[model samples]
Target chain A: MEISTTKQFDLHRRMVRIRLFEEAAGRLAEANRLPGFLHLYVGEEAVASGVCGALNDDDHITSTHRGHGHLVAKGGDFNRMMAELMGKATGYCKGKGGSMHISDTSLGMLGANGIVGAGSPIAVGAAFANRYRGRGQVAVAFFGDGSTNIGAFHEAANMACALHLPIVFACENNEYGEFTPRHKTMAITDIVDRAAGYGMPGVIVDGMDVIAVHEAAVEAVERARQGGGPSLIEAKTYRYYNHHGIQNLGLKYRPDEEVATWKQRDPIFTFEDRMIENGVATREKVDEIWAELRQDIETAIQFADDSPYPTPDQIMVDVYTKSSTTIGTKS
Target chain B: MTRTASIVGMIVNPNAGKDIRRLVTPATHTSDVTKVGIVRRAIVAAFESGASKVLLMPDNHRLAERASDRIKGDIEVLDMPLSGSRFDTIAAAHVFCQAQVGAVIALGGDGTSRDVAIGWPDAPLIAISTGTNNVFPSAIDGTSAGAAAAFVASGAVCLSVVARRSKKVVVKIDDRDKSLDDLALVDLAFINSMFVGARAVRDPHTVHAVISCVATPASTGLSSIAGRIHPVGRWETGGVFVRLGAGGRKVRVPLAPGSFTTMEIAEVRRLGEGEKISLSGKTVLAFDGERDLPVSAFGTVTAHIEATGPLLIDVEQTLVLAAQALMFDETARHISEGNHVY
Candidate 1:
């Protein structure tokens, strides 16, 4: 009941950064200024912002293909991320990894994955490493609804719960897997139900409500840090754009009314209203925050645009490591 | 070119039974799977009993939405942003009120009902027991509940005749000119606590006073603390006030689900109709078994008894009224003899 304005403002800042940064990427992609297909994190910004807010700087996380939000929330530098997405040398992976393979080892962000369910196992591995180090840190696996049906998710969940690992499996059930509806792909509506099969506590939260997701993540993170074993969190969310691009592909698979219904509960907009009502921020402050983020995102884009691309002669260099440059510093 | 038919509003609280009480007490977790089955049965019965449309409250778990697949009638999920709290319940009830719904069936415990009452105090409500606290709702099967709901909804049984007017405790808290008014269908406790954490009032030691709309020993909860000594009926004119502390008659009261504590009652008094009482508090107010709001230090918190609760549908009574009112005739007799009515 005691609403913390500071915590709320921090959460708002993180979400706005992701939204503005992704919107910038979207604008570039729409104008053909950016290359490659992007799985944008447009609607489901609350999941990343909420989960990463509850985590420590050293706490690890493995993100899915739609992962710009995760990286930005986890203290990722926007200039480096935009540069990487733009395939510049100043990018996170020196431009080779591009959008999907961005990672920050020092910040404990494992990587934004290209594969559907690949992050689960990596998060499990990170948790195992954290356990081996005897550190009280936790690792989170961020995946989508369709990813839960994969063999990797079940195997990782079983292993984590069995080993009492400090990990949280955060499922962003956005009702779609690429083009197909989730109901057509899976029988169970709630992906968290599978957590019980793996002998872990499953929590379902409204991913549109950042506070709900944040509270759930905080509880799960605390439980994992206290050696209470892994827990699964399923966030009921939605993606505003198409699965692969920013363009309107005119997909007939989704109902028009459902889209309108979800847009009514736009996380950022509703959260702004909630913040104002709860005395966390004023309308003026909300406007100021958005303006600031827009400016920040523009600067990052400029930084990426001015940077150099990967040179042809240096293709063999930094591709492999030890056979490579040292990790977590400029290559 | 179309006739407007009656609509039944169904509010299924997915977060109801699953709370911190599951950790503190051996409270039964109402799984989403169970909720789905209940909603399916309820929707089926409501349709079978002549309800035309049903509007479901949106939740993280698609209990009603999933159940809609099997329902062979008009169904729509209310278009609103879900906050995943009691605010969702209140908002849905408010929508249902504006729409002038024929009936509203809410699935949760007393807190769920309290939320609905706050939104629309006179809503024709059928509260089914699904969560931890058990004051407002009853253990009615989904089939019977759905049928009864439709009976009221479709004018097969009139709400004014079948549904009873329940008493409620009105709470008004004024702090720095911002006034918030809330209602409890059962008991409102002034708890000696700091914050409203976990929502449920589990610790009996932290409780100081209770004002009840219906106090019966059979109705298990904080109300029973007053109920065991001085009983009050659901259709009663007024409420009961009980001061909690030591040095009085100790009664074993069921506080939370699967947990009961011996509460020593210091004083008990009967409140008259529209009788207002002041609770001087730097305390947390637990309404209908959940810690709702915190009273600031030396804030003005006053409560009064009113007959402004929901139009509670007595499920069996509705069915019995239906049977006596010519429903147990040739159609029913034919169905009873294992033949189709139509």
Candidate 2:
């Protein structure tokens, strides 16, 4: 999975965009400007950036509550997302879906679901659709390690295997599923082990390393698109912020030392250093990208501010496809 | 107006709504999975909306018996020949079709609806949510669901105008052998792209389905994936394999066991009114959720989509209209005369 110049640069830009977007959104959420529950994807940027980078526009991806990173990584407009978080009229869901439920079907990014392990079966269904039509498209479902234990996850995995649907079940094992340590909550250490029961390949990747994740995801996506069966990839990543709101320190859960230990392998710094070490990019270029991201974040903020609030009538819309305007856009 | 009136029959799956057993004996309730409560509510609502008679699908499950007891008006309990198996639901549906019921009101998830639909094609169908994976059932309340059914039964709701007709895929195995009713309604799944199976439950094998409408135009199920990429499903009706978990170099399709996790499809074909699906493999064919006959490796199957169908009425609307009619303080003729009201 050697990175081509175009792919590498695209990954770099997307990683930066996700990080910056979260940082901006985190600030607004802290200031109480943004409404509802906000789960920042500050540290897990590489995972989404890398995995989504391998997907084609026709490929499908389902997201979790902490889905802003996936949304940005999959080419969703930052302005509309920001507007949605701000409850503006121009948001992807017309302000109905905020931080947790952002969606853009045109981008093959299904809305982030609030339920755990909910997207797994849906992605399988989407993959089934692709295979049935003889299309080379694939579907990906991104969820947390905590979701592995849910019946939905097991059911979906088994179905995926039995059906041989083209799908990649990407589990971002962020250690804590809302304060509970991964070890204490479950008997299985590796979420990938669950994949064995379903009789599929389950690969573990360093979620902190963007290149590693990209390589692994690329294979899975290609296999899916080429009529191969589904695969489950468990990306071991860490979240910098608390489960919700501003980053809560410990909050009576994880130890300070454990947090510090994981922080030592910060994905962002590692990527930046790797870029320089490989002579692919310089510190100057990195700084320039950061500057550009800052400008983009500012523009998104303006868009959200200028965006209108959805009229009350809009609320009556979008609940069903009979009323949805985007129904006919699918191929 | 009398010519427009359609006689719609209603049936309920006893394993719908919240899992009440989860509160106490999590094992018992969660084990078999029942939608009886949802079925009961939908039936009651339908009866309240002037449904002359409703059919309650029988099962050994206490939920079905209890639900059957709850309906308001005169009701008929159709005893399914299958002792206590899940096939009882399908048998009950067949009975309703044999009764020449103009339409079918199905209460359950996609599986239940699929079962009833296969048994009674072009029969007006009103599906209400009561099962776990509910893509076909309407989320509307039981009262509304029953009302909609009543209106359809009484010839108030128009099929071509209000109800959207769904396409069914006809599948055949070999040159001449077994067959499938509608292969695309989550009926057939190709596991790991190798083995063919049924159902959409948990498994490692990939799923393959042949669909009539895939391009976001039909039901959002396993077939939607193919619709997005190839869009071939929109042009024709057939099965496509949606692969799931990774497997050998071969194109493996994941399928459910008996019904929930895998399906093996020997042949793929289109479905219409006159077309039939044939299977050639020694594989078993499960229609909807009920187990059907087995097809040998050389069996054949065929399917054809029936365009002209009965008008499906919404139970909800039917219930609402019935309530309104009751409030009119007059007879049926009086309500009919009041139709001129602005």
Candidate 3:
């Protein structure tokens, strides 16, 4: 697939946004400013930017624990997301759902699941809804390589195929599932092979290359939308940060050399070089986008800092529908 | 030899229930999570009622499409382009009309149903309320609504016998000699506000509501205001017109969930069918509690009651008709013969 300049620029812009947001989140978490656990999507930016770029705004996506990249790629507002991470009342879910559970249903973002493989079933249900309604829209499930071992993922994959649900199960194989590496948990090297067991097409893509991932996703998404069954895409990528916000713990698990090697093939820098080489954008224009993204992230952080926390009295509210008289009442 | 198959059109608005009310008032958020479950139940019920095929309106969130995953029936999504606007609903309705669907089941609030009505004025509709201000749509169980829709679709119950043409308030621009093709099925409120701020009738005092259909006391929004003053049954021939302010008798009404406000009724009158009432001023006219069109200063806009809205299926009545017709006798007998009867 030929990558147009507009598409390349957009992909770069989205990757920059996710990277900047993740970096800012890392800084905040390190300083103990954020209220909850932060999973930075630093090195795995290309997978989100590429896959989301291939989807329409109406298409649904169920994200994993490391979901900020997915949400941002899907056009989520940085201000509300930052506010949510800070547990502010103005955030998504009214601060009731923090970073791990942030969702903007208007954008077709199902929600960021905190539990491993939890989003798979939700994605299946979303795909099912799409099929039942006869809406030719596809649902994507973005889970980590570790989530492949979870039963929900297998069940969801099986159900999606049996029902011929229009869904794409995109696994970000970032080498490590929390502290343990991929080899330690799974026997197979490529997780996409498991799609065969579910009677669906499985393909592998270079997750570090945004163009490759986007091409793969476009094909998978189109197939599903056209009534073709689900497809599993295994994107080979690596994470620069540790499992959580704590960078120290990450260093203890992965060696410095492996991290350095992955950084050398960093998605952002490689994409920037490709853009310049392909005459898509100048180095200065790419630098400008990076600078603009930094400023945007700063504004979002400031907005989150200024936003107030949820009132103590609001704790019981939003638990259920207000139309129901039985809910939230002391009977 | 083949039998004629029944097809039901399903439209689920993902943007439904996520309005400014959640942020402005104490109303709880009705996310896509709840809508997915409702759509699932509706689809299953439609299949159970012998619907051979279902046409789902494609939406941004894929609410209906996702719900179709588990259903084993032939489901076709309307192949119309979507702009992620209300026009999508209108386009989908047009497709359903062209396809000559047995009935259309709309999962949304008043706005969604109104859009469907605009496309096919006489099409049979089963409106399930899923939005903030839900006066037009009924809060019936999804499964029952689906079953009723299927009954009509399958010709198990005739549409004319179990359905009624809804009442609507037609708006006409007097100076421009133009009339809005869209009709408000429940209440049309002429607000004193200059602009359509937030697209909701937030301040109840600024509303001068003219309802074409019945407004029950149990309903909410501007319809509730009319319902409080004079309760009109659904089968009533006329409507109620109320001028709201702080000068008349104070009546408490719920504008949104968990949010109630007291408003005064300056004038209340009965508006008979085909009766025209004119309003001249710079105001935002809200249809079914959703502020849509704006009239300039000194502009005259007339609202007339019309009994030509879409045919709405009464779920209970349709189910009763199905039972009376022994629609499920064959399946019951089959199960009994197989020794699986409960």
When candidate 3 is compared with the true two-chain complex, its DockQ is 0.02
Model 2 residue B121 CA deviation in Å:
76
- For lDDT, the strongest prediction is 1
| Model 2 agreement with the true structure over B185-212: per-residue lDDT tens digits | 4444322211111122223222323433
Overall lDDT per candidate, in order of appearance: 0.83, 0.63, 0.80
TM-score of chain B of each: 0.92, 0.62, 0.91
**Over the stretch A1-331, how does candidate 2's per-residue lDDT look in tens digits?**
2466677779889988998999899989888889899988878888998899999888899999888999999998989999999999889988888988998999999878888889888888888888998778899999999988899988998998898889999999998898798867875556765665676666666788787687678877877777667777878788877887586444868667766867887877877775675567899998998998899899999999998899988887887766445656853
- Candidate with more favorable, higher lDDT: 1 or 2: 1
The top-ranked prediction according to TM-score is 1
Which prediction has more favorable TM-score, 1 or 2?
1
Query: Highest DockQ: which candidate?
Result: 1
Least well predicted 10-residue stretch by lDDT in candidate 3 chain B? B333-342
Write candidate 1's Cα lDDT for A1-331 as tens digits. 2336787788888888988888889888888877776878988888999899899999999999998889999989999999998989999989888788989988899999999999999999999999999988899999999998889988999999899999999999999998898878876767766777777777666788787677678878888998988987888899887886576767887877777888898878888886675545799999999998888888999999999998999798877656345667766
Misplaced by over 4 Å in model 1 are A1-3, A252-264, A269-292, A318-331, B1-27, B39-106, B111-126, B132-134, B140-165, B170-183, B187-272, B277-303, B308-342
Task: Determine the backbone clash count of candidate 1.
Answer: 1
